[model samples]
Target: MTERRIVSIWLPRLAIENWQRRNADWPEDLPLALATAGTHGQIVHDLNRAAMESGVSKMSRIVDMKTICPALKISDADHIGDTKWLARLALWARRWGPWSTPDGTDGLLIDTSGADHLFGGEPAMLIDIQDRFASAGCSTRLAIAPTRGAAWGLARFGSERAISKTDPLPYVAPLPVAALRLDPQTLLLLRRLGIRTISDLVAVPRLALMRRFGRANLAENPLLRLDQMLGRRPEPMASPEPPPRYLVETRLADPVMDPSDWLPGMIKDLCDQLAAQAQGCRQLRLSIFRVDGVGCDVTARTAAPTREAGHLLRLFDGKLENIDPGFGFDVFRLTAEAVEPLNAAQPGLDGEDTEGLALARLIDRLTARFGADAISRPLSYESHIPERSQILGAPVSDAPAPLARADRPLRLLTPPEEIRVLYAIPEGPPGAFIWRHQTLRVAKHAGPERIAPEWWHDRSGTRLRDYFRIEDPTGLRLWIYREGLIHDGRGAAPRWFLHGIFA
Candidate 1:
């Protein structure tokens, strides 16, 4: 098998030119530069080669830069714009390889083993990439080798070398110590020791070199060692492409004005498309692009990796209505964000889909149509108070089925309504009370579930609450709470509040 090689391409002056190309209105012939104002209120960080060649280095004052390049057109560096374009670049580079990872401030690494043949081998791939970049008006230096360090060195140092897979060492050897990406101090040390070129350092014995410069020092050195150069050491690769998976997209022939008309179909189409592509994928993202170019995205996750079209479609039904489709959606895309190996399983002999996967899908659809929080499963909290003991959690596909709670009366008050009690016990439920402008007699009642307030949260200075589930003569079930204990010195007689009514 041929040795797999990692290609690293560096664009030294990418930022400055990227800015100029993005803003086409800017004069192309004029020497342009990007600078930032310093703390002293003058331009700092000149970002143009022309400006630098004219003696205007980084952190140079605006006045000095102008004095050197009288015709230089300078603008403030757009860091946000740079980042956005960089992401686009990364996405575009994903077309060339299965793995493409960013390198430093302005470079990209492409894994070429499985991908190189598609572009007619290494040299053709490089030429294609170079052509694409040049067409985009960006200059790039391309290098390929068995190691990232070697590739990086060649890209930055071997500028004059031919763009081929020939031995990279000959090209990298002539470069200065700085090309190794060593710290300034390290480079200064190397210079002092007369170790000017990478070739000079390569001549030294490994043990002696390591002993002179400790292991930590060697770790900081960016130069690839001979072992790595010869493919002995594995070069770690950061995958630039997310992964091969499924994606669904919809482009409207005409702009959509209302979400209701198009959302369901768009979602269904996206889900179906994604399912078709998923094959062995796990997670899917639903992306909606409005006519105005704005994007709204949501994710549908599964317990295990699945490519089931029906299951995925049902999953998205839960969140479909959440998409506004704003001012008319022109495009919709569903991408499988993750995946796992598919495992076939046999159905149970009992033949019951007791998993409640269907119910979960129903809940997801309901939540999607209404709102995420609109549908929920009751969760128990470690509290005695009825309201405090129970909480609502967002509908999830993988949560264990909830056990049925005891039959309770419908209609619980929010912040249980306070009432004048006809009969009351110092430590128990009230027998009868005037509530909601009506005197309700308590026919049956549950005992007090005294819940102490978390003392650690006493910074709020609120008293503990005691709760009781009370039933009225009219079959109304109420969750009420009594604020403050009998002897807490924070005097304001205990107050009763109606929280909720159970259905």
Candidate 2:
């Protein structure tokens, strides 16, 4: 088994240097300190070399620091910006390792287990990392060890840049308690107990120390850190996983200007792969790479998830004509841009009736030829109003089942036209009404179906409707309604109108 190795990179002056790089006009010789809000007031968070030389140390009051160094430059520290840059740096450092992650706000941790040989050796790899960061105007201190804790301690506090594969206790024994990554309170407590260094703490009995500081959190416990640094405890690196891709390509021996014959076979190969993964394509794109370096592509979408090869072939029809295969094509790639799980469907116990599948295929073809918006079916909407009862939606979209009612007309008018009642019974549809500049006599008539306005949705003043199915002398049927009752306190006297027409 390959021995595990990790690298830790620290940037002590990250905030100061980031600010300097962004503002090129600022003099590098000036004493600059980044300040952040503290309990009392703004305090120095980080300082440059010049500020350090001028006695402007971290945690000092910015006002006092200004007095100590008359030319001191103070700016608000951008912790978020520093962290974002550190994350990007960690991702870019993958050239030296299989996995890397941002350790904190100003550092990175990389797992370079068996990859040091690519750079000749461990020392060579560290030197390469230093040179790369130096070229990018960044100051970095890096170290490698058998454990993450040891590498982290050495990068920030230890004297050496690389530790051998042997036990790391000797290298970290003399380091201060802070190297254990403990909280400020723990460090202070250790100091009062006269345990200033790792060696001093290790000399204390483990049972006695655990009794004094209950073993609750790792941040406050020192035993966990010691065990981790000595490789007794496991510390797994949290690396990001790459996104999944579904693509297939074909390289032709000879350049062909027309890909009509090759498209079917490539599509079949892609469909077979999708079936193996138990997924069906929702959208597919075909890319054509030309020998002269020009490229063209086209896309097709389905109404529902499907892996059928015949249906997909028809969808791409007339779409490839727009692709100008410039100077012949050398590559053909088929990729599924979007996919969804499609479990194997069980066939009916009796002989299969493909009526539903055939309808879905027809809808997909029509949608691909035109556009999804151009082909839609009526979807029942949850409303009591006749006009608001249904809406247009995707042909294959999921919707609530339509409401079942009686005596509905095939055609409906948007805004019912007002009719002059020539004759009619009291509190009912007009017997003989004038509509569209013509008079129609009622040969036979059905009853008054009362449809009240929805109280929650309709306005307070909205009136109820009394609908009736009436037939004329010419065998024409009409759906008419009275706008209001004779004396419903909400509105005026009842008015008649033509609402819909029956076939």
Candidate 3:
């Protein structure tokens, strides 16, 4: 088989921010920024090339950044917005090649072997991609080569002449060793030894170089031998495409202001779109875009792959109210976030197993209204401590597969509290306990199921605990615990705590 060439694209920070600002209605000529606000205040995380030349760099403190560019127009980073646009771009770029992956935060790669002709050949495709992005206000570098490494080096450090597939090495040779993706220490050492360019490193003997740098240095050492540099080995491309799936979008002609007037219809439309797109897919994500510019998204996952419109819609009923068509939503999009291969198992002859499906729908609706995390099913874990053993999991799905042991208490305190006992057994269960300012006499008790401390994770340095399930005079079930062991002789008397109650 002939060697398969690769095309690597790089969109530096300055380029990406410019694109975002232009698309978001900001002045195209003015310096722009995307920052994050934290306790220390706003910090610049990304800047366009103009801003960079003006001394603005990634991770620059807000105060310092202001000093560098007083007229900087800053916008809080919108990761979600960026991701949505990236997905769209990746989808569009798929027309250029069979494979494409996002490069870092602002770049993309395309395997252009068989698809270059459609864009008027390799050079034309490169120019076309660059123009498309530039039209969108994005600055981009496009490089094509026989290897990912070569493409990456050329795109970021190689001059315009280096981008051509033919005679690529001559252009690539002049770039610094950093293009090889070498670590700082190794690059520093190489520089000290008069190795400034990739060509210089290639001239050195591989064994002698390895001996001086040590084998560990080879890790991330981008220098490649003749055969390796020429792309003889397999180099996999991580795709930038938002996995293989379908998404449905609805753009309202006019933004609806009244929730009562728009919510039901909007939700119905979204579900219909999702159902149609998810023909054989199992997982779905629904994103709602409100007129105010804020967006809300939720995901619905099923035990098996499904495309049934009714089942998918019912799953989202609970979350519809939360959509908050803020100032009325102008657009809504539904995407299949994940999918599993379908073998098309034949349905049973009866075809009427609606009970499980009905329950799933109810759960989905409840989750939609209260938030996906609001409703959940109890799942048991392997721990004697009441609170540690049972967990609340999403309601739309069953508990984790290979369900954990179910011997844990039914109810657990939000935070276990200390309790005083009037009558207690030093070696066994307590006779009476005082909890929440109320004292109750324990009529019966069971368990001293001693649970050892997970020392590997005992950050608190507390010792093991012995737990017990005690019944009070009113037949109320209580889960209590005592910390440490008298026999261990490591601390004071064991302290008592009330961890949970059984309904």
Candidate 4:
């Protein structure tokens, strides 16, 4: 197997250069420092060349930095934005290698194994990388070696930009212990023990060093870093995984006035991709790019998640009529915006779910003809009151579960109608009632199910209700409820209400 060659790129003035790139109007000759809130106050996080030349160092208080450089420009540091920008820059660096990753907040690490020959040799590759970054308005120090640790150390501290592929310890031994990436606390302890550089630390007995600093922490132990730098330990390069994208595009050989013929093929390609992943799309967008530098898009939404080409193609009917297609279109692209997992299922022998599939297609067609908000269905809600138990929502949403009680009325009134009890037994169901200016004689009755108000939502005057199923002489059954009990002190007299009717 070929030895792995890693490249480490250090951006010493990344934060400063990034800000300057965004604010081009600022004078480059004036000193500038990026400040971040610290325990004492705003502290200097990073500075440009002019600020460093003026003797303003990192971590210096902003108030003190102003005294040193009277014309210094101070601005709040965007740490998060800088980190994101560095990640993007590292991804952009992958043109020369198979993988690249951000190395701290201001550096990048690229694994360039077996890739240098394509751009000449290792030296040429490093020069190309340096020139490219310089052209992009960035200051970079780059080095390549057989090990990540050695490359990292040489890029930041050593004079050489390329180390020998056979051995890297000779070049790494002269660098300072800080190049080992040890913490400040460990560096301070090493300094007190008269250890200043990698050579000095290597001279000490391994047992003595192990006794003083255990091998528990890989990051803080100098021996571990030494082993890694000398190729004794393995360091794998890990790159960030980009987000999944479901998009396909076609480039026409010549500009055409109409893109209608190209859309089906593009949509089929997109659906095939989704099918390969066992996924389906609920929303899609078709975009046409004109040769005149103009672009237009039309979106389609489905009643349910589907990857069927025929169903999806019909949804775009009459959608592209308004597009001007000025000059001509040279490209067509389709993208799936919303996706969901769709596993395959065996069809029943009797073809049971065909009706359901047809209903969903009908809803999708109606929605395409009208608008998204025009098609809706009722979904059951978790509530005790009949009027608050169902709500209207998108037709494709989950169907409401069956009611637990079979005695529920087929349809409920929006606002229950008040009724007068013409005659009734004391504390019992009414024998006769007058509703909507008509008297109804009751024959049979079922229940007086008592229901209590929701204490968390109801006001003080709210009272309990007693519901009953009453059948009149004409065989018409009504759901009736008493609003309050007699002498309950919540209201004057108990009132009766016609709440619903049976099927």
Per-model TM-score on C-alpha atoms: 0.61, 0.55, 0.47, 0.55
Tens digit of per-residue lDDT, candidate 1, span 1-503 = 76667777787676787776667686545666677768776674436555566666766777777888798777888767766666556555655665777787688887777677877877888887787677566788888876777787777777632343536667667777676767778778778888898788888777766666655454455334544554556667867546645544455667775434444555465445544544455567766655432456677666445555566666655455556655666555567677655544455688744365446556555655665545556665765444565576645544444454564334445545676777777688777777768887777778576677666645456777777788877787877777887678776778777666777
lDDT of 4: 0.83
- Candidate 2 lDDT over residue span 64-121, tens digit each: 9999999998889999988776766765566567488988788889889898997889
Which structure is stronger by lDDT: 1 or 4? Answer: 4
Model 2, TM vs. native: 0.55
**Highest-scoring model, TM-score:** 1
Tell me how far the alpha carbon of residue 203 in candidate 4 is from the true structure, in angstroms, after superposition.
6.2
Per-model CA lDDT versus the true structure: 0.65, 0.81, 0.66, 0.83
Clash count for each candidate, listed in order shown: 25, 0, 11, 0
Error of 2 at 213 (Å): 2.5
What is candidate 2's CA lDDT for residue 69? 99
* Candidate achieving the largest lDDT: 4
Tell how far residue 495 is off in model 4, in angstroms. 5.3
Compose the digit string of candidate 3's lDDT tens values, residues 172-268: 6788888876778877888899999988877888788767755454444544433344465556787744343465555566776533344345445
